[model samples]
Target chain A: MNKEVLKALERDARTTPEQIATQTGISMEEVEKTIEKAERDRVIVKYKTIVNWERLGEEQVQALIEVKIQPQRNVGFDAIAERIYRFPEVRSVYLVSGTYDLAVFVVGKTMQEAAAFVWQKLATLESVQGTVTHFLLKRYKEDGEILEGGGEKGRRQPLTL
Target chain B: MSPRPGLNSKRARSLISKRVEGISPSGIRKFFDILSTMEGAISLGVGEPDFVTPWHVSEAGIYSIEKGYTMYTSNKGLLELRQELTRYLYTRYGVEYDPETELLVTVGVSEGLDLAMRSIINPKDEVLSPDPTYVSYGPCTVLAEGVFIPIPTTVENDFKVKAADIEKRITPRTKAILLGYPNNPTGAVMERNELAEVAEVARRHDLLVVSDEIYDRLVYGVKHTCFASLPEMKERTVLLGGFSKAYAMTGWRVGYAAARHEIIEAMTKVHQYTMLCAPIVAQMAATEALRAGDAVVKEMVADYDRRRRVMLKGLNDIGLACFEPKGAFYCFPSVKVTGLSSEEFAEQLLVEEKVAVVPGSAFGECGEGYVRCCYATALSDIEEALRRMGRFVERHS
Candidate 1:
């Protein structure tokens, strides 16, 4: 798995191949090969920047929709999950155990748009027994990055005893 | 108004010791005074880590206080802490010290340096050390009434204090050789064989060796050779190590010294009268650190390695000549290309670029053409600082 190279990149995606070599105590060529393999094998799905959207004043409506569905003879929950995840508004989908068969993450520009996805596309599906929607109000942390340590981060006093 | 209170109080200027008065003020002080008023400035001046003490270590300290273990520990420190240090030294350095007699916990490696010099140095005795070494060594030597003989090392030799350079400067009264590795300003580390040569010299000269290994855990792509572990050196070497750089526990003010029973005893005697002991809470935390925080230190070291590579490459790419530094968090890049003194480079960079670096000459005269930039800062800030420095160097050049 070349876990060291993966860890170096996972901690900081912007880390260069040369830096990955230094951090992992490996050669630059090895780091490049491992990362290339990871990308090709889908172990590393994508490299994307985590922007502070709130700073740009572009607020998003994100909701987690817990869905229960009847299991089909041939494909249990997998068919309904694919059906729910294929929609443009649905950001992520996971088949969870316990109270719900699948937990869907949906995002939209407005609450109405987010709610309508549950009502129109998700709830109306066949064998879609029930659904509950919880809207995300605020994100204090995301993707292992603290969102609040940024705002009002007063720089330390320049010189002191 | 008659003489203003602090501004015009001048009666006691001569009362200061002539020894202290002879010492020059830190060259970086002026730059720091200038930096204080500037807003949004990035500082590469600090010598310590940007990371806080690991939460697990702090949790252990809190847990100790919760159990009412906050009394003044033994003058030497808690027995358990000393035992942990014994195990650590044995396991890491392949050297052993008796927990009961040979190890003494002190306030910090700073205090260890002070106590070691004070205990062994007689009045007017000369101590051989590196020219551009840690800033504390010279002052501590003076405070102990010892004559400090600076053996200069240049960038050509990777800033290491060579045995021949040190041996040539030794005199009849030369009592000891003091050095810090994974050194502070230059980030230079002496290899095992290189230091073994120095150890041979010490054996020939019959001098003590005081090794401050505060940055022992911060070396990148290099192994630190503990002086006391080398052949026939342990009996004459006083090893100083601490949790400050390793576990990011600087504010805790805890460190230890291990040596032959005599040297440890003498330093402990000085410690008893002057500093008493390291704080019990900190001692407790250190004990926990030695036991459980190896993984945390490794993680921090890896993070620093990534930042070090970036800073080195970025600075070198921008035309600042930095010989590869294999240890510590600093990168001492030559700023002589700008036709400016080290102090002037640091000052102008602060004023124009709003990035603060310490002039390397603050360490010694041989450091004149260099500036010490600490990479303990954030990676994004390092990149940004490099960009500003690139423009500054371009403008000046």
Candidate 2:
């Protein structure tokens, strides 16, 4: 068995080599050897927290801000959208074929704060001609799961003749 | 220069409206959409109660139609319904309001919530609400050009928002606090003392309290407290209640809001422009529900309690950690043992065992490793769901 692989899986990546070896029932030498190789091969990525932003007292606002941009003669609309999305407030950016050229998901503390951020920060940026922001009215579910509808129980056995 | 029709295009042109793009559809409907396409799929993905509308309630709607009550009522809705709502609030929660001056009946709690946000929120108002709450609050805040500040409540605290936690999130721009008792995902109910503390904070901060008590009647053991009933809170609170959960009339889409006359007046103006009025038939049925649907409500609550006990026991026995829900027909259990994320656990269960449940993260970012299984379904289904869950856990382990 790859001791480093087992060690990495046991503890979070940020853990020290000695701790991983102790936890994963592997030798420290093997742990170092495997982790180095794993990192080089791109098997282990960066560590992250399943952050509870709400607990942090941060007002998390998600809205889809649509934008219409006129690209310069040499540069394209993609180039313009790229520049707009470079701002920290923009969480996600996508270019689509529709009424709007680009859709941006933005987060802010308040509606006015978000509006100011967009108007002063995004709208004034070069290439942006017009923008329409649609606030998400209600989210029944998100991230590929249902938020409601789990109280009742029904059984379904596969048809076995 | 525009390209000619039928010419080769360098980029794909979008036919969809700019308004529609980037606006995610309701997550609750996604399961039903997929369920509809799949043949022989047993779904428990709906949010409403499964029972049919009580007989007397349906008859009231029929009687109203027979009496030719078809013409549109006032923009704020039927005066009589508002009067009854006022009475109901007073009788149930000791909250007082002038029906004509303070109450406005909407399509459902959903519309009331939407109208409240639309009328009050300008561009980026910050709305404080508890995490793992009813799904609509966050999205509605976004749609109304407001920020959703979710206050995470843990199972250890029984999912009740701590007053201290609320104080931490408050900023200069924070305008309102959205409260949902007998909360959706966790079924955690707040007692009167807890609510009083929140009200005290709101009073001190001059923040509006949007209290959603849709599941008020379904609460077990804990007495539901109306935030507006507290002194000083009466002026700043906007109360949302409905007949959907209590009377098993989900499809009817009927609910109402109780607030100060000024706020109600503003909501009525928005309601007039957006939706002329709630469906007359549904309103009629809702009126009947308020008049005489206590027995039905009790019966449904009884069934839910039974299932809650069974499901709670099963979950604890199967090595899953679960806290007994105080209200609403849902059970949130921790699936940390299976070594899978909530979504992965749910997907694997559905695919391998034909059981459907929502991942907790679907409610908010903090809901990872937990899954919300609604207990609104029949007892047989709950038993089987538990059985399948046990088998799945064993296999995974």
Candidate 3:
């Protein structure tokens, strides 16, 4: 694993290859080859942006759904987890160990749409026994970024010893 | 003797004491004053990190306040904080200090440096330090009633002071040798073998060595050698370290000094009477920092290393000859190619291109031909500043 290159890209996916080469003291060609190999090997799955939708006056609703399911023959939670993750509305799915068997994150344009997904799709799965849903109210942080009050930053004096 | 004409203003100023009056104001102050009023100026003048204190460290301080733990700690500081510091020192450098007797916490390395000088210097004593040194060292020595001696270092030597240069400047009244590496202004890191030679000079002369390691953790691709950790040197060295640079906790005002028991006792006596103790909330935060600050510091260091490389290359690419700084966040590039003094270069750049840099003369006499550019800023701002500086350099040269 070219951890240094990966770390730079993970911090800011838009960082250019030349910048990575300068930062990690690797040659430009090596950096390009390593990134290409990593992408081919699936070490880097995808590059995406974490947008603050509220700033644009867009309404978005997100919810977490805890699902309970009966284990099927030959394929336990993997089969059910895969089915839950394949939905476009489901942002993420994880096999959790607590009282819940699977934890699923679902996003929609409105609260009604998100709640409808829990009732219409998740609760009606064949092996699903029960489910609980919690709607997210506000996002104080996402993807390691604080979502508020950074406008007041850069108050440090222009010059200091 | 009779209250002479109620004192003219000039006489009144003189009454403030010849020592304080003789000390000139910092060279950095004048440029920064001009910078403050300019609109939309991009500054590479500040010497501090751009990151805020990590959220967890700040949360710990808030938690302490909620618990009503807002009382003054012991004169030496909270025992638990001291213990944590000793463990860190030992683990990192193999140097052990007694938490009870050998460590004293202060407001910052600023205060620790002051206390160290006050506790050891006597009238007419001489304190030898490298030229192009931190601005505070010379003033602090003078304030402690000691004579400040400068050993001039050059870019040819990568700004590392030679032991022979130091030995030649020593006099019978010389009391201590002061060192700050990963130096300010120059960003030079002293190699271990070179420092051992300097330590030998101190040992032979039976002089104290006061080492400031505030930027120890900021070195790029090089290991920092703790002067006190050198063989047989711990007993004669007073080590000053702080959280300001490493953990981005400048406002917390927490730092420490470690030495033999007697030295700590002496510094503690001065600290108790003048400042009382570092704030209790800051102490609590510092303790939390020692416990959980490693990963945060590692991330910040790596980020700084990247910026350092970019700034180094940018300065050289623009026709300014810059020595590669292996430590700290500054790039001291010689601006002599422009046929302008360091101050003139800084002033003209701010006026013409709106990019502010500190004149290297602010550090000391030997720093006249260079200007210090700090890279601890946003990457975009650094790039923009470099573009502006390139334009300015092109016109003048």
Pitting candidate 1 against candidate 3, the one with the higher DockQ is 3
Q: What is candidate 1's lDDT per residue for B18-115, written digit by digit as tens?
A: 98888877666787888887887889888778887888898999999999988898989999999999999999999999999999999999999999
Which 10-residue window in model 1 chain A sums to the lowest lDDT? A152-161
TM-score of 1: 0.85
Please write out the lDDT profile of model 2 over residues B3-81, one tens digit for every residue: 7877344344365554345466644454444444555333444466767677789899999999998888888888778
lDDT of each: 0.89, 0.79, 0.92
Enumerate the chain B TM-scores of all models. 0.97, 0.93, 0.97
- Ranking of candidates on TM-score, top first: 3, 1, 2
lDDT of 3 by residue, B108-170 (tens): 999999999999999989999998989999999999999999999999999999999999999
- Model 3: DockQ vs. true structure: 0.66
TM-score of 3: 0.96
lDDT of 2 by residue, A1-161 (tens): 48445434543446677645443445779878887777677666645544545546667676789998786787777678778788888888998888888889888878887788888988898778888987765455454333446423433222100
Q: For model 2, what is the C-alpha lDDT against the true structure? A: 0.79
Residue A114 error for model 1, in Å? 8.7
Off by over 4 Å in 3: A150-154, B1-11
What is the total number of backbone clashes in candidate 1? 0
What candidate 2 gets wrong by more than 4 Å, as runs, is A1-161, B1-22, B26-34, B37-42
Q: DockQ, per-model, please? A: 0.26, 0.01, 0.66
Ten contiguous residues minimizing lDDT sum, candidate 2 chain B = B7-16
TM-score of each: 0.85, 0.68, 0.96
